[model samples]
Target: MKRLTLIAAAVAAAAAMHAPLAPAADKPVSIGKLERVATFDGAMPTGVTVTETGRIFVNFPRWGDDVPYTVAELRDGKAVPYPDAAVNVADPADPAKGFISVQSVVADGRGRVWILDTAAPEFKAPRRGGAKLVAVDLASNRIVKTVVFPAEVVLPSTYVNDMRFDFRAGAEGVAYVTDSSLSGPGAIIVLDLATGKAVRRLNGHPATMPEPGFAAAIDGKPLPATFKVASDGIALSPDGDTLYFCALSSRRLYSVPTRLLRDPNVTEAELARAVRDLGVKGASDGLESDAAGAVYAGDYEHNAIRKLARGSTTWRTIARGENLSWPDTLSVGPDGYLYVIANQLHRQAGFNDGRDLRRKPYELLRVKVNAQPAPTN
Candidate 1:
């Protein structure tokens, strides 16, 4: 499993792979506490999600490294792969059927773990075999069902990066994903959980891509934004009123009503109109929304987290540069702590001078939310 190599490539220029935006702050976000988590030392951990039992699962996106336990179940403060990995009992060396690169790991309303694998070898060209969304029973830690994306919807250039689940969609569940394609315009792909059908709408909404001229300072040096779809962080407001998102390259955050984003019949033109710019919230790598209606953003600029209060008009820098290292992602742990993946991405060879300057155990820090974490799905 080449999770490290894949991330070094997938997340590179990701801040702008969707859309490049203007720069805002040069200071690092202060979020406090920098400690290494065991799981991240070997793989370039890109995504993390916690279950109801306080068990944590982190995934590596097919980065170029041998990942013995790329997708693990963290217990007793230690990380272990969920179930004993056996070669596809169906076929051994094919590797295609095995647990490949999971770009995102999400815990849904039912407390189920959904691992999204871009499946493509190195995520180089989006292929069908590598495009699957797996539902795992956390209690048993085994894959139950694997939903494959339709080939037409799975563009060869697509990098299905991050995802959000809407269980109420059509009485079953729906998954909204961002295809931050590195080689072309980005798009938002929607999947129907029941029918196994998927749709690609707003294929190139300006709001879904990066803002032009968007530049960010990583490692004290200027790095151009690589605006693509995946870098555009998407999160649901606690009240579920809106879906907050922004391009990693841009300093601002924008959102459209969740009602519109999930409307299967909503026209692209309407989606274009539904987009509401939330203005700049500094620089960030990922976005997550809780049930309290506040949208939490991991400010990569200041190494802290920022929030947009429910119904508020301005962005607030609630947490900043507090021992955070290039905060890579933002999500709520089942224990109600805001979990962060500080991958120190920019320090890697992609942005730096051919080096893996990230600290060992790459930190996974969490802070208690204002209240109990809300379940978006």
Candidate 2:
């Protein structure tokens, strides 16, 4: 017994010597400091964009919330009806005349803020003249243009999720939109800013459609198999040559040449052949690009922000924390900060068996990205 005890002590000592002397303190890996810019206690905000002069704008979709105004400018922590309250009034009779179920607001960095009106509340079909893009001139705070999508382009099941602009494309530039339809196959809608003509590309393509049998897991709980969103997050390259996009239910990122997308002559088959799968980026909601050519994505599954540097194929986490619950949208501002919305979308009543697990005060968070907003022109 004495010999056995000695042997055991020697083995224990050897193990202790090999182990970390102090069980190295658990250090959380974070690349940037996340700063809370604002909080939404009333209605949840889905999209956020900052102008070159630092004007912050956010949109609240009519998703079962008592949204007094669909679009608002965040000023002094208050949600003020943007441009005025008259335009925000949802007139079911004249849905195209005002903001109805606005889904995203994007500043073109060229003194224009574009509001994308999905006009499909509760994921319902859009009314005639409801689905459109309204561009407001920032300097004048006046509606400069309203392009109502045709019935064919904005399909009955189409949910215009997000869009990015490239002013260098056509005479007045072009806009690329993602149709993240939950009920139907997804596709990309390209709008010619000059003629207000919209064309659908990659319609029901495999890349745009959600991955079969793939469901998102939030907070260690896998979402229901029925929960699938396709072709949601989108970003434009700095040189205006490539457009990168990903589906909400997929981790794979894909890019296609903007030249082909802008060309009406390109056939669907030819365009699909040009799409290059950029491999897995975490399940992302919103994607943004900087003037430095790096693309940033809100990695909702990891509660983090990731970046794919120019000429690099791998994604690196830039910011991560528990507070980043459901990073829903990403916008790179002119102030060299990447703004994100943590709206806890997975906890919504629809996904949580009608329990609405979301807590109050959804967050508008930003992290210093050391990069400026991509040039719109």
Best by lDDT: 2
**Residues 1-377, candidate 2, lDDT per residue (tens digit)?**
99999898777544432232111223323445899999999998999999999999999999898898989999998889997899998776877799889999999988999999998987899877899999999999999999888788888889999999998888899999999999887999999888888889999998898987666776667778888888999999989999999889888899999999888899999999999999877788999999989998877766778888999876777787778888988998888899999999888998888899999899999999889998878
Any runs in candidate 2 off by more than 4 Å, and if so which?
Answer: 1-31
Backbone clash pairs for candidate 2 read: none
Query: Candidate 1: global Cα-lDDT?
Result: 0.68
Worst 10-residue stretch by lDDT in candidate 1? 13-22
What RMSD does each model have against the real structure?
A: 9.0, 7.3
Winner by TM-score? 2
Worst 10 residues of 2 by lDDT: 17-26
